[model samples]
Target chain A: MEIEIERNLVMPGDVVPCPTGSMPGYGTYQNEVGEIVSNVMGYPAMYNRLVCVNSLRGCYIGETGNVVIGRISQVGNKRWKVDIGASQEAALQLSSIDLPTGEHRIRSEEDQLHMREYFNHNDLLSAEVQSKSQEGKAINLQTRSSKFGKLKNGMLVVVSPNLVARMRQHFCQLNNEVDIIFGRNGWIWVYYNNTNELEVPLIRRQQIVRISCLLKLMNKALVMISPEKIQQVFERTSDIELEDLLAESTLERIKDIDAVE
Target chain B: MTEEILFYGFRQDGRRPGELRQIKIKLGVVDNSSGSALFQIGHTSVLAFIHGPKQTKHEKESGHIHCYFNTAYFSSSGERRKFSKGDKKSNEFEANVRTMFESVVLMENNPHSDIDIHVLVLADDGSVECAAINAITLSLIHAGVPLKDFLVSCSSGFYSGMPLIDLTYSESTSFQVISEYRVAVLGKSLQIAYLNYDDIGGHKLTPEVVREITAMAIEGCKQVHFIMKQELQNACSN
Candidate 1:
């Protein structure tokens, strides 16, 4: 079967170029006259009978099973509020997280009082979106797996959330040197290694910093970021110094975009 | 009072009756704000910044719109007065702008948040509100805030029995406008969103004058929207 891809820029109040019977999807609304109109500025696309506009600069909207990186903003009763750069702070219920010892047991009353010890304010962590709240727009996050927990010795870099493509595996090891988590909320965390944070090799540290810089450079150029693009940029920019990685010349050269058209 | 406001069917600045001042728009000037734009028309300039949908102290069923209108002390020539934050004129103008955008933005979509629009008049020759409205519209687009339509605004007035569009400071005040009107509209549909005017030259408010001036203002807004759309497309294409 052949696939078709057609995209045209449309802003708010612009009528969508869709068949008269198609239903409107995200980033669009049907008027009283039943004509589909775009409510955001973006590229309108058709999927089956639904038409949606992929907005250019919109903030991240949540989805189930997606990974996110966030900082603990507040500790409340039976829950922790996290700043994931979304419309509302996500909630991590006391019962949804795994204890530090990897033991799978019921969360007792003590856990509610000692919530700060598990994830205090300003502590960064990675988790998967479990669900959205019933009455509100808040997202519910879970850290049931060993892979999701407090992130240390890693620096966070934020870009446009849409630039981070959805992939099967968000956690990846780059060149066997650094661990990268591409959060759907545009927060990227890169660390050398989970076990060895107190002492680090000089070369590994430079590589980790370089990856963060490259992510920022791609963001400035409005290019989509994926692991394949990262590896491609890494292999191509071998001659450039770490400090010069984000220079205008370097950004212009590595912009052979593969994913974002 | 014998100064010739119009010489040879041209305004003092050499623009014809229907002609608008040269417009220049620049987006994303403020890195921190979600959206920001600077709009310049003739010598009048306004900078607008959109900050949120951010968490506020109180959450509601719909988002709240806040407008802060500030005129920099140096914005207007020959006026060295400090525009205090609570100036009654500024407060009224700010409320009018806020209400203008509240009708255009899709507030129901952004539940439990605050969208703050801060408009700064960097230079004032005439029609700062029109420039501010244009700047805020561009800023909202840049921020990707959902809107019903682009809210484009323009000011016009009657000069010596002949109607003029996009009146300058001198044309509005010095030339003794027979009538002056400011309008904000949904550009694509030409639906009037807000309207206010004053006729100080003692000209009778006739239906003919109203129709003619309104058509002129709508035309001005359409021209502005066209220019903005073109610039935005070109800016992102490369």
Candidate 2:
């Protein structure tokens, strides 16, 4: 018997169980009987557990609390307006800038933050969505952390915004080293081939296969270039040098592909 | 690659005088876009996405059909550069695309609507515009946009006194043995979208060279149309 998720059970970065009993969540793996919660759909609500489930969610959209990559469209009074793959522009206030506390005290429109000093038009940036409004058109953003800031000197690749959510759910764990931003409006900003930042958690390889499976399903709904293609593209075009491990992995994939044929 | 031989009766990439690069096309990759397709010939990879058939955003005329063709060219380093908003290159491309598409698209079906085509070149080894047209046609078909016929394009250059099928970046940028043509063929009739020549100043290409290149491009155009047809059949059936 197969079980289907009536709702979204997990976000991208979440860890689930493996049925083989060797991986995380295997201890609590439920096979025969399960309880469904109101907000949730399936069983084994633990830090790490295995349960058969289905995900029936609407089309992925960008939202606050999500880290996104955007292009600075304009600079204005103490704030920067960015096109975060959203229908409406998101505002990044000067106050949201994470400057050292001891270095600066007083804040003024021109004195605290000069528009050109931070980001210029057409500059790609990595930021976090801070908030949204009643109309749902307006968005606030922040770049206070070291990880969040202008993405200078990098190649920015944008894909269909709808794929952003799916990509983001499995972010930072791709076999290929890269940084990605899942914009709400189905736009994905990928900084190709960033080896320094791509720390493949043990969980990532597991999720990658899952992503591949979902992508296969999506391929039926619409004609698509698979995630593997995108990953290959990043590896091919990335500015970073291919480490030995990465090169070996690529060779393995190439061999596997050839072997299948 | 060295030692250009004139009247050699052989072209680079092992083609007999006049031949075209192999073409592979897949339509409707991006769902949100009404129409989309990926075109590949050799190492050149281009993706074209078509949106619209909606009401015209530009207020030219109430029922006049509008077609916008925007192209993104990616360099060898993988850096992408777009044409200016209303620059000369864009104006020329837009005019050619408008004219070429208007000829085939049944604009009268939806007089007041618009069709916007965005061609994104993931890798531009050479013949960017020609590949773009092939991809766009498939995308439009996938989007179910009504059309009178397929508008196809291909590039040819005079190299070693022999017409090359599709010039690679090195060959295109080198301007060696150079009389290039951007020929658009629709069934029996042919239209020249843009033509450029280098090195041979004030001298017209020989009639033989022109004929050979035109025939090669038209043949390639037919292949492109075939691919577009199959892609449409697949998309519709699915």
Candidate 3:
């Protein structure tokens, strides 16, 4: 039997009261697919909150206060701006930086603030959103805590914007290790197992895009997502994670490319 | 009989051309939205949400409230919709929705603050503009954003020589001689915010046709206004 779950609506774990004419248990899910157990169903209405299905749910994007892998773009007298992918540039205040001075120094405009000495442009750093504004605007961020700031070794991936938003929400709720930074435009930066260095950025990018594209296709049926093709991208990142289908020669060829990069 | 069959005697749904389909409305469907509602006018189903009327920071743009209308065709039939740059017609619909809300919403009340209205379409049948206008207004009410009065809107299209009150999926299809009227009604004042037309017939369609269509459209607005007021009253009473 075929079963369908409504889109965009958030359904809670609690049982829903059947609508006036709706059959009891007809719209509720009994199994993992969240298929409406009841055959009689009402036309899914707009604004209808749906139950969350793991497969149909889209990926999340990074948000304000979200720890993100940001690239240092520009530095100024009082602060340095980091690009966290939100519309506005996230600031890394002079005060936010844990300088080696042992003694905390006060910030003043008169103090010489060179952009390069502090953070040069194109430096892939990490920060969080200080604030969010309308029309995709946001404030610069800083990593005051020990764990935050500057993603030294990781990979970044990009996908459509909607996918990032979905994934971000999910991560926040589930408390997962995948730290995702959603560029307000279209790219996503993820840092998983920061020790892996070169592999993480590429892995995050490929994984995010693949997962997002797949969720979108499954949910909207707007397109078909090839999970096999997505899994293939990981083969180049690590041999241990690769599937058996890829030839040893192909793996060796990818390793040579990785070595050069 | 010529191909120009008269729908005046009967509609596809067996209603008169001047008649509106059934309207079902429910408020507060989204938890994240300050105010939200689901509206179904015949087969067309739309969801509208209102977020904010709160203070807007500089980066958030002005301390005052600004209104934003987002219309997305999420699921149309079995096809998943890609976000287009909002073609001309869609842009016009967005603009009209903005204007209609601007009239009723007391913008000056919350200077430097902004209100956001987002409409997501689950299905599309016909008369999208009217439905969006109605949905946004209801969302505002649901959100409890202060307003001078209820601003309701409706559209009437000219097909052949007859002016239909509200076009259905089939009748609303491209007509040779067609004019679309979108008007916002606030209190006793009626504002013709948008009027689009193509003069296909070999005649300079007089203002009389426009006036007639406007009158019919206003009548539809009044009907919608009544329903909105009743909903507000019910909510207050409860």
Model 3 CA lDDT for position A57: 17
lDDT of 2 by residue, A164-244 (tens): 443435235355544444445444444443446555454443333333333332333332333565465445424433233
Candidates sorted by TM-score, best first? 1, 3, 2
For model 1, what is the alpha-carbon lDDT of residue A38? 90
lDDT, residue A134, model 1 = 61
- Fraction of true contacts retained by every candidate, in order, equals 0.59, 0.00, 0.00
The residue ranges of model 3 lying beyond 4 angstroms of the native Cα positions read A1-261, B1-8, B59-81, B159-161, B174-177, B191-204, B235-238
> In lDDT terms, which candidate is top?
1
The CA lDDT of each predicted structure is 0.84, 0.54, 0.52
TM-score of each: 0.93, 0.44, 0.45
- Report the CA-based lDDT of candidate 3 relative to the real structure: 0.52
Kindly indicate the candidate among 1 and 3 with the higher TM-score. 1
How would you class the docking of model 1?
A: medium
Best-matching candidate per TM-score = 1
Residue B46 displacement (Å), model 2 = 2.3
- On DockQ, the leading prediction is 1
| Position B30, candidate 1: lDDT | 93
